[model samples]
Target: MEALLGIDLGTTGVKAAIFAAVDGRPLASAFVDYPLFHPRPGWAEQNPADWWQATLKAIRSCLEQGARVGVQPSAVRGIGLSGQMHGIVLLDEAAQVIRPCIIWADQRSEPQCRWMTGQVGAARLIELVSNPALPGFSAPKILWVREHEPELFARVRTVLLPKDYIRYRLTGRMAMEISDAAGTCLLNVAEGNWSSAVLEAIGLDPALLPPVVPADAVAGTITEEVAALTGLLAGTPVAGGGADNACGAVGNGVVRPGLALVSIGTSGVVLAHAEAPHVDRSGPTPRIHTFNHAVPRAWYLMGVTQGAGLSLRWVRDYLGLPERALERWTDLDAYELLTREAEGAPPGCAGLLFLPYLQGERTPHLDAYARGGWIGLTAAHDRRHLIRAVLEGVAFSLKDCFTIITAQGLQLEQVRATGGGAKSPLWRQIIADILGVELAVTNASEGPAFGAALLAGVAAGLYPSVEAACEATVRVVENTAPRPELVTLYARFYEQYRALYPALRTVFHALAGLS
Candidate 1:
């Protein structure tokens, strides 16, 4: 059987998976973790070399596992990539790394964001890119570097996003796909190409950015050297994959309109597929992002919650001493123990709410200075209450995105849940009740990796098109319907959750200054 390989370069790790091209059956998979560096507060950076090495390890391990399962490396016909979006990796003329990559979590570009808003009026800026200029985007990072590190900026020859950099390493070519390019804030999202106007407004040359193509297009082939390193056949085609969220949508069979995807990984996102670009230019603050989809001639409306699973992770590491002890005793994962404890607590956690702004917020608020904490905490609140409140808070945050999506007149017929948090039934029910929508868990495992492999299949001619691939490979595995009583309860609490951010806005800014 022919096999396709997918590689995901995530914020925390590199994952590689092999899937049968015909029906998307998973054959083998491997993951290798990497460290995220915080050289200073509000800054996140990673070495391109580290990503390359980790990817090599992951690919070799995946191939070995496939071999053990009777799938040969030679059977892998195509490769695709998915990765963390909006990271800027600079290279000199010789394609040598100019500096460590400034990643999606970095917040050092607020001033540049403000400057861009001033140069090209906020409304015009949104008109050009279909979203507001934010600190985490590539355009602001480019401005930040040009102003702060002019000498280094002068030496820069090419700019690539996180996964595209890996593509360069594997194929010896520098190119980017539309879905990932849309996040760069340099792309004309509606047109599915780089915006020369935005580049000119920021005094950046168009030559610095790589060419953009559709996600399923063949980017390049695996070179002999990379093939040797990963035990893959030379001349294997590599498809231009997508931004993680876009690929995740494809993996979950969210290729058409009316199907929404809620992803809860290190961050949270609510996305809906759009047949045409739906730009919300009426709002003074554009809360939703409209980006080119991985599916050809389509778009997606997305709202992001910067801290989703990260909140649960924080509770697990910092406040789950009992759960940790139990984990050692019972061999249960700390998250499992924590969620089990939380399941005992009543929904809404007796009026306690969490903001989940530990890494700041994106949808609705767009404040980089936002802070996260538990509100309405009293002596009556225990660890169970805290854990349940965190889960409920993330669901509420996603509900914020759902509100924006519906406001745009996009009907959400089905909501598919994908990511680490979606594995928990309790959390899935919470999200369903909070959003007032039925939730589904698809048969597709490995989310973005699976989508990448499907794209690889299309590029390799194993599938006629993206829709055909999804029709053949993706299926709904489970469903969770909203409970009316819980939905009413969550509706009341969601209002309370919404009020906390505005009330604490000034205080959060003040605390950020003090720090």
Candidate 2:
């Protein structure tokens, strides 16, 4: 039986999974964690060598698991990769790492973002790239390096995203795919290629970028060195995988129109597949993102919330839940305990609301200066109310994305849920009630790794196309419908949630200045 390997270079770790190419059933999986460096406030970086090391460790562990399950490692037919998007990895002429990779979470390029917007003209920038300049994108990060570290920028011969760098290390090839490249603020999203005009505006050469390809296309074959390191065949094909969210969408079988995906990890994303590119640059508010989908020739609309699960994590650590778990020597998760506590509180949290902008917000509002806190809190509220309010706040933020998507003329029939937050029945029900749409849970638990494996199956010709591959492997496992009474109650609370941002904008800016 032919098998496939899918690897995800995630923010905090690398995950590797082995799957049957014939039916997409997961055979074995392994994960290896890595540290994210925050040398300064609002700055996040990771050493690329650490990612490669983690990838090798994960693959070997996964192969061992497969062997114990009676699957031959040599039967692995193809490899696919998915990872965090917009990270800038610089390489010298000899393909040596120039510096540590600046990841998507870093917010140090705000000044560069403003400079790019000024140089290209805000309206023309949107016209050329189909999105506004933001601090998290690759273009601004490149400009930041050029202005701040001119000597290091001069040595840069090539720029690659997080996964493409891994692909380069695996295959000895320099290439990128459309889905991940779209987030760089360099791609002409409508044309599905790098924008020369934008590059010129930023004084960058087109040669600095990698060759773009479709997400499912075969990028190259594994090198002998990589094969010897991981115990795999040297010539195994490597597919041009996708960005994490794009692969997650593919993993959930959200390839066609009308179906949407809501993924809540450290950050939250609400995405809808589009038959054609839908650019909405008319509004003053930075609302949604238009990017090439992992499905060839297709597009997607995405809205992001920078702090989704992060808010819950902050609360969990603040409440000493993990420490308490350690003391009891229990295998119970801190999030599960938090969710159980939330269940004790009534819906709406008796007028208490939370703003989940711990790392600033992205969707609807593009304010990096925004801060998070509990509003409408009273002496009557307790820990249950605080936990419930956090959950409701996240749901409310996603609802903001849903409202914008509907306003853009895309109809959402059912929302497929994925990621760490989806495991909670309470969170799923809360999202359903808040959005007033049914929530679906898929059978694939590995998220992007499963999607990457399916894409590898497509590249190997095991399936005729991506859609067919998803249809063969993906299935809806559970459904949650909204309750009428809860939906009515959330409508009023959502109005209050919407007003908090506008009222706090001035105060948030002032607080940021003071800091």
Candidate 3:
């Protein structure tokens, strides 16, 4: 019984899932969490060593579970990796980690972003890399380190993304997959390689970057050392995996045109598959991102909400203390308890609105200084209204993504939903109605990990191609359609939601300054 291993290096944890190579059914999985360090406000960092340790434990536990199901370690034929994008991990000459990885959520590179725009002309930069310089991108983070940590930066011999660093540990190889590389603000999206022009303009050494490879290509084989540690077979092929969103698109079967994916995880993304690169160069800075897809020769346009599930998490931690206490004695989850209460609130939250800009605004706004808060809060509103507003606000922000995709003439015939937040029935209903589209959930519940497994299947010859693997395995098991009355109400509320951002833009910047 041949199986595939998919390892997802997420922001908070690493997950190892074993899947049947023939049909993409998950066999066993294990997750091990690591802490995210924020030494200063607006800065998110993680030790790559933690990721490596957690990954080994997760794989061992997953394989142990698989063994109980009659699968052997040697049964695993291939491995695929998926992870958070835009985070930078620098390795010194001795292959030693020079500093903690600056993750995607870190916002310390605003000045570097300005420097990028000043050096390479904003419009021309977009034309070169198919996206604008954002604080979260790898290039800006690199620049930040170059200036702020010059001593450490000088020793940087190689730069890797979160997952690629894991791959290096597993295989003793260093290469960046194209899909992940595309998010670096250094890759030429249409060409599927590092952009020399962008590198030159930014004064970055191309040599510090790894060779680019296709998502399904065999990047390297697992080393004997890794196999000994994790019970995987020595020389097991490891596919060049992708960024989380790219793999999520593949996992949800959004590989071709006319299909889009809506993922609500720590962050939120509305992505549409495209055969050709689509750049939003109309504005001073492009609103959406055009990145290479996990599927070879394909591209995707993605609109991101910096805080989607993160916003709800804030409420869960701070405001739902009662629910958390109750959870100790009950089987109901704390989030579930909150959502049930939120369901009792009216559709429009009685005119309350939430802006899910807790981290910062992405997609249409592209403002890292923008902060999150509730608008139209009144004495009449309670916790239910606030909770519901968070849900509705996330949906509305995603709608901002959907609206831009359609306006650009991308045909989104179907919307597939994935991620932690998508599991909520209430959130799904809100998103479906707010977007005025039927949201479908596929059987690939493991999200990016499952998608990574499918990519492994292709690399290992279990399937002919990524599309064929999806055609064989992924199917929509549930659908949530928009209710007409709710759709009308959300449409009105969404207009008001749109207005709040622009109105608060100046104030948000001011608040950011004060902080």
Candidate 4:
């Protein structure tokens, strides 16, 4: 039996999973964690060396597991790569990493964003790149390095996205797939190529960027060195895989129009697939993002919430000491215990609300200075209310994305839920009620890794197309329907939640200034 391998290079770790090439059933998986460096405030960096080491360990471990099930390294037909988007990886002439990667969550490029807006104008930037010049994008991060660390920038011979760098390490080739390239703000998203105008405007050389390939196409073959290092066959085809969100969409079968994906990881994302390129040019900055989809000739509109699972993690780390202690003796997870406690709280948390801007706000409000807190708390409320309010607050922020997508006239037919938070029945129900839509959970709980495996299957000729591959392998296993009463309650509470951010904007900025 043939098998496929998928590697997901996430923010905090690397996950490698193997799946049957015939069907999408997961065979074996392994994960290896790595550290994220924060040298200064609002900055996030990761060493590419760490990612490579983790990827190697994960692949070896996963292959060992696959071996127990009668699947060998030689049986692996293809490999796919996916990772966090919009990160800049600089490489020197000798293929050495020049600096630590400035990842997606880093916020040090606001000045670069402003400069891009001034150089290209906001509306034209959208027209050129199909999105605003956000601090998280590759172009702005490149500019930040150019302005702040010119000596290092001058020695940069190539720029790559996170996964593309991994691809190079595996294949000994330097090329980027279109789905990840679209997030760079250097790609003309509509035309599906690097934007010369944007590059020239930013005083960047086009040669620094790698050639763009289709997500399902074979990017290159695994080199003999990587094969020996990771226990894979030399010359195994590597698919030009996607960004994490795009791969997540594919994994959950959100390929066609009217289908959406709601993923709640460290960050939350609501993405709607579009058959045509849809640019939101209504304001100075587009409320969300429009990028090339993993599927050829398609696009997706994405809205990001900087903190989703992150908000729940804050509760787990700071307030759930009892749950953590219980976890040592019990099989239950700490997050599960916390969500169960939240079940005791009534809907709306007794008028208490939380702003899940622990990492600042994204989506409709693009403010990096926004802060997180519980508002309308009363002496009568307890810890249950605080926990429940955090969950509700995250759902409300996601609803903000859902609202904007629907406002653009895309009638969503089905919304697939995927991520850590979606595993909680209470949290899933809360999101359904908050968004007034049923959430379907698919069997591909492996998320982007599963999607990457399917893409690998396509590259290996196991499937005719991306949609065909998903149709054969992906299926909805369960649904979470919204409670009518809770939906009505959330509608009223959502309006109040909507008001909190605007009212607190000035104070949030003031606090940021003081900091």
Candidate 5:
């Protein structure tokens, strides 16, 4: 009858899951979508209140479903939070939201990132923390507010990451977990707390940040006000969980060193779970990120591709609108419909390469202004060719990241794959062939939400340890291997795909009209 609940505040939605303390199998789960706001061309923001409301709705739905499945709402003992990383949430002295939570994908703080790198010295910064500057990181966003909204900056009291903000609402506690703080670019990763040096250079008071804690530790209990609003017990324990990605890695059982995961969500990422810190100081500008593992004192290395599924979504919603009229003729899904016709697309899209940078790019490019395109489109080809090229281009970009991960000394024997895009057999096959790694896909797609519930089980004394939770719960459903012929074909095409970015790098910037 015992159960633990996990709530994940994701970029696209919020998910709540209830898991049995006995075996860690998820008993029931629910998710609800919320709106995203883009005030300017490059700015992406969300209301903190909306995230809290969406989380509560998702949790209530889960509690209802759990009761239907024989686990009553009161059986939910301990709860943990998993949320998107690098978001800046500020509160005044009275603990009121001072601004919209600057989300992880927003690119409005490029100048702040450059300034921090210059002031802190990038090498010293990386040595102090495990990662380098990204425009979306929390510290850079904080600096952005100071430089742009100075009046509001003067009133700031406490700064919180996305899940930290949620936890603040739930338990009236200002605290953060190490894995979430790692993405903030303000944490001393080795010390597992805020870096005073970075704080001083950035001109922010160290006291403004929350006290850091380990992911498994309990931060506080739910307040009476939250209990009345959420319909849960007033004294329910709230654990500090990691960011969505780290918790997702935990959810998928990538707790031990040597295991890697391929997540093709709105953005794409290839992460390897490492026991010790993994840093490559020598080459490649070192954009690969490292964060403390959600599993007690562990670490992980990850490579990212920013324009994975979004590119396909863009193409389908924009360029392929005519293809839907084509959709009425067949039962195939848009991807299947496109893939069938596009596979007929010759290798390299018959010289039609796409950059896949619809929303800028990350990993190899790291260029926010990096625009996307079809290099050689013609009247001879139609929509399917363009659509397939986007998919292949995304796969090729992911391979570029995987190549870096391999360079950093992580062996790639197998990869555990998850996410919405992972459902497509063709995309999965394409990634397997392009990366040249055997890929295993799991059945449960709840990802970090499921992983958060597992952590809850650990906290509630349901499992001896986090390892035992994954060992008992996570299972692989299918293993995909690269076709020999397609692998050989992609090897040649990948070389060309890698070079295309640099060749057009100047042109991408020029077309920006930035000058």
Candidate 6:
């Protein structure tokens, strides 16, 4: 039996999983965690060499798992690569990594986003590219490099996303997939190619970007060096994978209409698969993006929140976590311990509300200077109340995405929740309560890696199409439906949660000492 392999180079880690193509289920998986570098405030980067190291380490671990269980490495017919989006990787004439990649969460390029909005005009930019400007996107980062790091910018010959750089290491290939390219804001989303006009406006050359390919197209084979380290055969085909968000949708079988996906990571996002590009020029529900999906010729509409798990992390590490109590009460499980405490609090967090926009916000507001804080905090509040507010605040943020999508006439019947945050039952329930929709949990929780394996199945001819691969392989463990009473309570609380930002908008930037 032929097995498929998938590699996902995510924000914090690299993971690889193997699945049986005949049944479309994962057989074994391996992972390696890495560190994120924040050399300066609002800047995030990862070394390309570190990613390749993790990728190979993960693949070797997966191979060892297979061997321990008596599966042969040569039985792996194809591999696929998936990764985080909107990162910038530069290569010179020799194809060496130019510098550490500027990741998706870096906010250093805000000035560039604002300048582009002024130069091109928001209306014309949206008309051309189908979304508003985002600081972490590829175009602004490219322009920033030119302005601040002109020496490095001039040395660029080709550019790739985070995972594409890994593909380059694997097969001596230099290419970008459409879905990942779309996140760069350099792609003509509707036409499905790099936009020369936008490149010119930004003073970036089209040649700086790599050639774009379909998400499932063959990228390259494992070179002999990689094969030797990985204990795998040479010339193993590697399929062009996808951006993490698009691949997460693939992992959950969100290929058809009326289905949407909600994810909570460092950032929050709501993505809906569309048959074509859908643009809404004017509404409270503004879209930051419509991008090519991992599925060939398909597009996805997305609403992104600047902060998601970041809120939880802030609450856990910097705020009111009762550390000693959690070690004893919840087996050192921070999320469960927090949720158990939250479950004790009444809905609305006892009138304590949080905006969860420590990094400003996306979705309806689009205010980069938006601030987050606990409202109604008093002597009566405690750890449990504060923790509950954190969950509710993040839920309210995700609901902003749902509101935007539904306002555009796409009624989401269901949402499959993924990411590290999705593992918490209390967190998923909070989201369902806020959105009033059923949340499904996928059997394989490794979203991007599993989806990359599904792409491998397609490339190997074991599955005829992406939909077919999903039907053959993917499985949902169960559904998370909102309780009627909780939903009712959250509905009222959500209304107030929506207003916190507007009321405190100016004070956020003021507190930060920004004009």
User: What's every prediction's RMSD, in angstroms?
Assistant: 1.3, 1.6, 1.3, 1.4, 2.2, 1.9
lDDT of 6 by residue, 65-103 (tens): 988776788889888888989888889988888889998
Every model's TM-score = 0.98, 0.97, 0.98, 0.98, 0.94, 0.95
**Location of the lowest summed lDDT over 10 successive residues in candidate 2:** 320-329
Q: Looking at candidate 1, what is the lDDT of residue 509?
A: 92
lDDT of 1: 0.91
lDDT of 5 by residue, 1-515 (tens): 88888888988788898887766677888888888788976678999999999988887788788878898767887888899888989999999999999888787788888899999998888888877788768898999999999999999999999888998888988998889998898988776778899888878899888898878767878899988887788888877887888887888888886788888877888888887778755464576787888888788888777778778877766766554556574666665565666666665677677788876776876677778888778888767678778878888888877887778887655688887778888788888888888999865567788777777667766777889988888888899998888899899888888788888888877876562
lDDT-wise, the better of 3 and 5 is: 3
For residues 120-148, write the lDDT of model 2, one tens digit per residue: 98988888888899877889999988999
lDDT at residue 48 of model 4 (Cα atoms): 97
Residue pairs clashing in model 6 are 24-473
Residue-level lDDT of model 3, residues 268-367, one tens digit each, is 9999999999887556777899999999889999999999988998898788646444756377777777788798799999999999998887888988
**Candidate 4 lDDT, 271-327, residue by residue in tens:** 999998887656667888899999999999999998899899889978864644476
Looking at model 4, the pairs that clash are: none
Candidate 1 all-Cα RMSD: 1.3
Looking at model 1, the pairs that clash are none
What's the lDDT of the predicted structure labeled candidate 3? 0.92
How far is 412's C-alpha from truth in model 6 (Å)? Answer: 2.9
Model 1 lDDT tens row, 1-515: 89999999998899999998888999999999988888976788999999999999999999999999889988998999999999999999888999999998888888899999888889888888998898878889989999999999999999999999998899988899999999988899888888888888878899998899789989999999998898988899999999999999999999998899999998899999999889764469788888999999999999999889989988976875584558565876777788888988999998899999887788878888899999999999988899999999999999998898888988878899999899999999999999998999998779799999999999999999999999999999899999999999999999999999989999999998887
lDDT of 5 at 336: 57
In terms of lDDT, the poorest run of 10 residues in model 5 is 320-329
